[model samples]
Target: MTDQDDLLPIGLEDALPARAAAITRAMRAVLDTMDAHGYDRVRPPLIEFERSLAGRMQGVATRRMVRFTDPESLRTLALRGDMTVQVGRIAATGLAEAPRPLRLCYAGEVALLRADQLDPARQRLQMGAELIGSDAVSAASEAVLLAIASLEAAGLSDISVDFTLPDLVDVLADEALPLAADQRDAVRRELDTKDAGGLAAAGGQAYLPLLYATGPFAEAAAKLKALDAGGELASRIEGLEAIADRIGGRARITLDPTERHGFEYQSWFGFTIYAAGARNAIGRGGTYTIRGSEEAATGFSLYAEPLLEASGNAREAARDTLFLPLGHDTAIADRLRAIGWRTIAAIGESDDPRALGCSHRLEGSEALPV
Candidate 1:
């Protein structure tokens, strides 16, 4: 048998040269815009104590994190799967007394257990930002603008940002239909899948005739208004609409009345960008308030691998250059190194001129006998 003690081959990734170069260049452009807007960069280590990764994220995300035992103290440790949670911990512990509103940015590889139907590799390169302890509309607007600017900088065209106010869904569902917890969850799941028939069944369409109706935002809003949604829920829906109106309707906007359901921590508006007809969303983010701490946060993460695949702007392959020395010229090597050029020393008479650029015809040298 092969040595059992041998380390398992690295499964996650080795970003191919071209892909790595492209990702680096793209990230630089995106991060530059972030820096210009007053968001300072923060580099958090890849590994932290297990409890550090344990705040606010769903159980799924928590379980996927790779864990180990510390050799010195035998404390449980884990590879951080998401930066935002770590950033939150940093804010809670490190920056507790620092400031009211903090703006931070990060670009790093995150490890997530491969979800079903994903490649076996768990490593993912992500670039994202966090705005903590702020609930202003301006902060939300800035987040949207940042998303637009970054995607455009990366050369993606015809991009559309879909803005959804998760609270609007909660308000509407609570007022329009008195759904039991299980029934409400089933309806939201079906709606998330955009399956009209399934959603109808989940909401018990015949008993609640309004459940099946679906369409553009205007139509949905009209339906809600017609239902005579009253009190705080109604006011919250109007408040959300005014926020959307303030966004100038320029962004390709959509309202999924079911938005607030899945991500338990999502507190307010949630938006995601989709490149027309792409299977995966290009990016996703939203404002959320942590449950117990009541700390408000907003941010998003770009799926670098998919974004790179969809992005046509990956840097071109570096030009190949072969260095051939007819005789022996140590001087040529020195010059090439000085000018920052790629070079290879050719030996003997069998070197092919067609395969090389700027080949040298060297003369006598001690290294190669004259």
Candidate 2:
């Protein structure tokens, strides 16, 4: 094959084992924090029935999910676009009998559709937890803690969480503005573009006050409350304030009514995590109570590429080591297997009693002899 042919497919690349290991360590740290909080770990397959995946997501994310058909049965299959939906399915069907308020955590790659600008096709190595069947604000609160602790546990300290809710838009939509549904979406698009003039044109005078009112969280929260935003919107602002207070007000929390774009599925609280120098947000999670279910569920996904990029400087370097024993290769391999290593065969062929293959190479350690 030619060198050109060796290149990876669009929006996908093979991560070196070392890089993948770094991601795994980061994910493990986050998962450990979740596990400590009574969140059980579960592994779902990379692929599922297309109907299952398609019906669960929409927009660019749904389109980005890789799809295929089973060869034997011709059942449509798709690589998951997000882990939360898969967990929701598990809660609805797989674990329906287990219990309510199920706490589940997972770390894996989610395939998302590519955009021409900024975000291209990417396999998001994500670690996240879901609080299913829970209606308490505490469950939502714990999700934030787990997410923050995940970053802290992975050595990412200089991170910010911008917490907001979707209902703010609903509030705007309910106002007696003359703009139509499409116009509202356009105003939203204009706000996203930060075009003040465009926002004024679409929303007219009523929207200008809201635009000018934007500022640091304290000011914004006060304005949101003053708007008489009650129900979900009001409650979310209060929740965020309480969370900020609990976290000592040093967590860099923000209340953004403009955060609702592209996240139609997130019904209640929404948040995005940003590292100090990163141009884009690194992690995002939110809560929503879906229909046919009485309880609210919430969760977040930690993006692996950006997380590793921001976290490289904080991670510790450890020396490597290799261990292999003689002819009882399988026995030694099993013993080491219990120790948790992504074991690979050592170099050279040897049949000696003490020459069987097995090796442990710490991340950056010297290469093992064949």
Candidate 3:
């Protein structure tokens, strides 16, 4: 019964009825949560000029996006790998004059030409809110809290947030510790690997203490503060504490100050949120400056695909479903439907109410149990 020609691409699959319903439910909850916070939802086109798409973020990799020459424009067009960049484009161009600290949220599909080792899917649903015009401690705090709220709204529980100072090295290298431009990347790489010897060999002996600065927020922040011999990281450390205080018992907090893995564009204050059953981060966000507009912003994006696993009520709920027999009154059926009953009209006498997935049957203007 299976046709070889009908096979889908490696990382793409059809979301059958049940799964599609769950995806819709999850996406609606996330968008509603953002709307409740006054963040307007935006729908951006799935394709854009490669140049425009890559110019918004400083280190965006346009090569990873699915690209082709547009016949009409005769220029390369790219399928977006991230929607945050599109939100930035909207804020800078369309909403340039729209008040400061503009709040916008979005939910859409993003595609990559090739799949990542960590996340095998080439296409995924990305939902997030961007707070344009500020990347201050307060903005960072709001972004973190809102992200946690969005996950909770989607029915995810037991969430934990891991914090990172995206610009930790640059901040320290500017004063407390010094490193040549070439040495900075090496130190960051070693720190990411947690290789103590590699860090020391890269002229980052002063950065060795940063290696131990991982774990609970309180303990890790203390270690980072103590290692700030010249007070280079004092402001960042305090900012982290202020944001953590606002998070307060909402979710578990941890710190990994030198984490730059998924934060190529994040300036500082990046966070990755995890849920109980998810094997990887469910969402990530941080503060960063838009490249073209040069505007400051803080935001987070939650991948809905992963949230599906951690959510308990992903299945469609049982409701009042009514079956209308072939000879049933159309007026009565309409009234039942208007009152919130789901109705399935029978086209033939052989149609069974139970077979049609109905819980009730229309009988003389009354909905009787099927």
Candidate 4:
């Protein structure tokens, strides 16, 4: 028989000592950056009533929630699969009477019923900031810029931002195409795969130019304008351009107008942040309407696990800790700690401070390099 101690459920694994410490430090750094930018920190519960958590949100997939019944109340409660929705609920009910454009930031562990092919872990550490009650292009711009800044503060550089219009399909559908559901799906598939020939064959010739509009900001913007997609589509493209202009020289910006997989609920501009050597998006954000209310908001959630992996140097460079010998004055250790040193005191006699992973040992009153 298999050993029970060695078994763990699929998509569940422990983040051992070094990795866990690194993840926490990286998250704290990003949160501190957000806090410095006037975004107040908020901590929502890990579980809430399913109705309140899922509540008619476009992007939240209710079926993927890990739900259970509360024993006392007998009401269905769900482990928060996504904090974005919870933030929206807080804004609508708890902070309903608060001022417009409330800025909030949060960080916590989210449990999902299943994992995507790209991200096999169902449990993940999520850190993000939400700008509620504003849908202006400026708000979107702020969200994107702040996301980039936060990642940089967390020791990630060479970041790239990919912008997308999640409602591009709806925008095209409103045109006089009159294609059936299946036909539209086919066109979307073509666009998603960047199959120019297939898209043209399926009455998507109007969108064919967007396939080539995938590159650096200026080039993509020029190609997009050349398409002359007037009305709302043109307005959306212009918003993207405005954001790119504001984000000048910070990091690389790219446009993928036809892509539409991740932003299920985003109505206008959506984006994904990428870093060199990271296999998945470091962060994602977009604009969406809060369910049960007319409030429009924009925000981004950064996945800490992949980001920690990408910042390999930061992960390995934990603070240098000093090991104190037994019978050493406690006041001495306190002074060392006050000066930003991590002091590990010896409880029993042990000469090998290196075994405890300490970089230095207390010799006399000073900490000498071991």
List per-candidate RMSD values in Å. 5.6, 5.6, 1.5, 2.5
Question: Model 3: what TM-score?
Answer: 0.97
Q: What TM-score does each of the candidates earn?
A: 0.75, 0.79, 0.97, 0.91
Q: Residues 8-70, candidate 4, lDDT per residue (tens digit)?
A: 888999988888887877888899999999898888999999888888487577788899999
lDDT (Cα) of model 4? 0.85
lDDT of 4 at 168: 76
Question: If both were scored by lDDT, which would come out higher, candidate 2 or candidate 4?
Answer: 4
- lDDT per residue as tens, model 2, 209-316: 555434567888888777654343556677777766665643676666666654567766777888775667878877776443445788887877778778763444
| Over 4 Å off, model 4 | 176-190, 193-206, 229-231, 316-319
Q: Rate the local accuracy (lDDT) of all candidates.
A: 0.65, 0.68, 0.90, 0.85
List model 3 lDDT by residue over 1-370, tens digit each: 5798799889988999888988898899889999999999999999999998898896678878899999999999999989999999999999999999899999999999989887779999999999999999999999999999988888888999999998888888866788999999999888878788999999999888888899999999998888888887788889999999999999999999988888978997899999898887889999999988999999999997779987853687777799888888888878778888889999888988897799998888888897
Off by over 4 Å in 2: 57-61, 72-75, 113-116, 175-184, 212-215, 229-233, 291-295, 313-315, 318-370
**Which of the numbered candidates is closest to the native, going by highest lDDT?**
3
Best by TM-score: 3
TM-score of 1: 0.75
